[model samples]
Target: MVDRRLFDIARWSLMVAVWLLPVLYVFGLMRLLHLENAYHTCTQARFGVPDDRGLPVFGRLDSDVLPPRSVCTWVDGYTLDRVPWFVTPTMFVCLVVAAAASPVVISARRRGVMAGTARRPW
Candidate 1:
């Protein structure tokens, strides 16, 4: 059998990890968008008219002048291109579900003799 302290620690670790997942997802999405923005602006300045708004994705020219692959820390043309629009919405749903479920889970776990210990604020 698992030690009770180790079990509690593992449980707390999992809870914290699940709670942070949505935050990480949001940061990732923002970074991906920022990379796209950087590459877009870079390409616009490189080949297209300055301050142009009609440029295609990643500021690719309507003609053959495509933006070169970005080497910046956040820029990964291949990965950026594959990031789906559904990711943000999916994360939103997961975050909401986790938030809603936490209280219910805490209440459920508090039904034992340790109820007093679980009375602290979530």
Candidate 2:
């Protein structure tokens, strides 16, 4: 049982590492984009804006203290890539699904419950 638990944990850990690392990284990148203002500007430029920047011209909600046309700029390329719309939230949803599935899979496997008819292995 303990071995099974360890195996389950290890398997899930590898699954998470393989499936989630890039997505999580991308999610983090998206957050950075919003925080650093690079994502906003890129989105703005895509919509045809005059500023040589990435996001829309309107400053973020918190930055309302700045001037109306206050253009936010980031100093690093790490902040330059705009997270595609809805990608971060989607990644979060996937993470949630993965987390929820891990325990269910572990429990089911530990019980040796197979959902479908098995074809005998030679």
Candidate 3:
């Protein structure tokens, strides 16, 4: 049997985490976008040439969400550059944790365990 105070503390912590997920995601996405922009700027400065429209004619940028890659690819399918190693993995872990926690929190709320006013059957 779990102590009531301990259980309430755990529930409150989980609630806080679930509430913060959106803010975390937004910040993570902003960081990812910033990194991607930096990658593009660097690639352009290194390999791009100004065409008629004055735009850098560097390689195209590509990205993947699951693995979280922002790659600059050349015309001939060569990889020019990519974002830092740490950002993507950190974001992935956060996303995974948020996904795992949502269901548990939702179930607890639905079962009235999170309300603190309901009695446990057990």
Candidate 4:
């Protein structure tokens, strides 16, 4: 039989971790949103060109006069957006913590059930 105190601690830990999952998710989602917004801002601030539709067009226009006497232009707007501090690490930590803690929770639940069954009056 496992120590009751240890069981309690493990059970509580799992509960706390489970509760923390949503908080972690919120933080991660916020971080991602902020990164996306920053990307949008920076993109518009840098290679943003005002198109005929009044939309910010990203990328550079390359004009080549030696290519069969034709002008060519291409839009290049693929880059890694900068995320705020602790976003990536926190995300990873949250994911790992949740994943690791889940098994612990399951074990605790199984133990609790077993303990309950063992104590049955019948």
Candidate 5:
């Protein structure tokens, strides 16, 4: 048996979180759309991110050009191996929790066991 109060809290929390899916989806799309264009410059110049290690990178303009992007060009390459602070994980968690908890809550309420009472799923 579980505490009815705790169960209610979890059920409502999951419901609220699941309701944010649309907002999160919109926010994710907005973020992707607002990103600056990297393939071309605003002034009609071809720009590209280069892959350079200990060697010089080349641009599309001239193959003879030893380097394409300067040191300042390749900024913001900090990619840590961790979960992004985006809506992806949050939305996933919400969906999973809601899916798992909805059946339990509904069945409990229907069985006349959840009328302000605690009942464990059997």
Candidate 6:
């Protein structure tokens, strides 16, 4: 029993968000890559070149998409440094927003179709 106008607005907003999700993901990926590059550069400068064994003194650069992290890890599998807290949370929030909105939008569309009230053609 939702107001028609409000429901339409919400639906449109969710649709818009769905379209924007890729853009959000791309930006998040770019940010993570930038962070990883910076970390590698800094670590290389701080720790000098690789050892006689041809292994990096600063370990490896690693990243994750979900919950988004860019990290420098030590040889012993310990994190040396990570991107700021805000970076990961920003991507996480984007993921959560997409997760929360997609189901509602899909259900509303399905309901509309079931009721023979879908206006726009898919």
Local error of candidate 4 at residue 73 (angstroms): 23
Write the residue-wise lDDT of candidate 5 on 1-122 in tens digits. Answer: 44577568767876787778667666555433313432232112213333244433322221111111111122233222112255577777777888877776776676555675544568
Model 1 accuracy (lDDT, Cα): 0.45
lDDT digits (tens) for residues 8-119 of candidate 3: 6555655665666555455445434643354455455455632224434455666565455656655455664345566556555656665665666666656566556566
Model with the higher TM-score, candidate 1 or 5 = 5
lDDT per residue for candidate 4 within 1-122, as digits (tens), equals 44556556656655675676566555545433322333344454345632334444443322222111111122444443323345445555656766765666566566565256435567
Q: Candidate 6: where are CA atoms >4 Å away?
A: 32-40, 43-60, 73-87, 95-122
Question: What are the RMSDs of all candidates, in order?
Answer: 11.1, 11.2, 6.5, 12.3, 11.2, 7.3
Estimate the TM-score for candidate 1: 0.35
Question: How accurate locally, in lDDT, is each candidate?
Answer: 0.45, 0.47, 0.54, 0.46, 0.47, 0.58
Error of 2 at 115 (Å): 9.0
Return the clash pairs for model 4, or none.
none
Residue 23, candidate 5: C-alpha displacement in angstroms: 1.7
Candidate 6 per-residue lDDT over residues 9-104, each given as its tens digit: 656656665666666566656646643355455465446642325554455667787655667776656664344556555555656666765666
What clash count does candidate 5 reach?
A: 0
Model 5: pairs clashing at backbone N, Cα or C within 3 Å: none
lDDT of 6: 0.58
List runs of model 2 lying over 4 Å from the truth: 1-21, 27-81, 114-122
Highest TM-score: give the candidate number: 5
TM-score attained by model 3? 0.43
Q: In model 3, what is the error at residue 31, expressed in angstroms? A: 7.7
TM-score for all models, in order of appearance:
0.35, 0.37, 0.43, 0.41, 0.47, 0.45
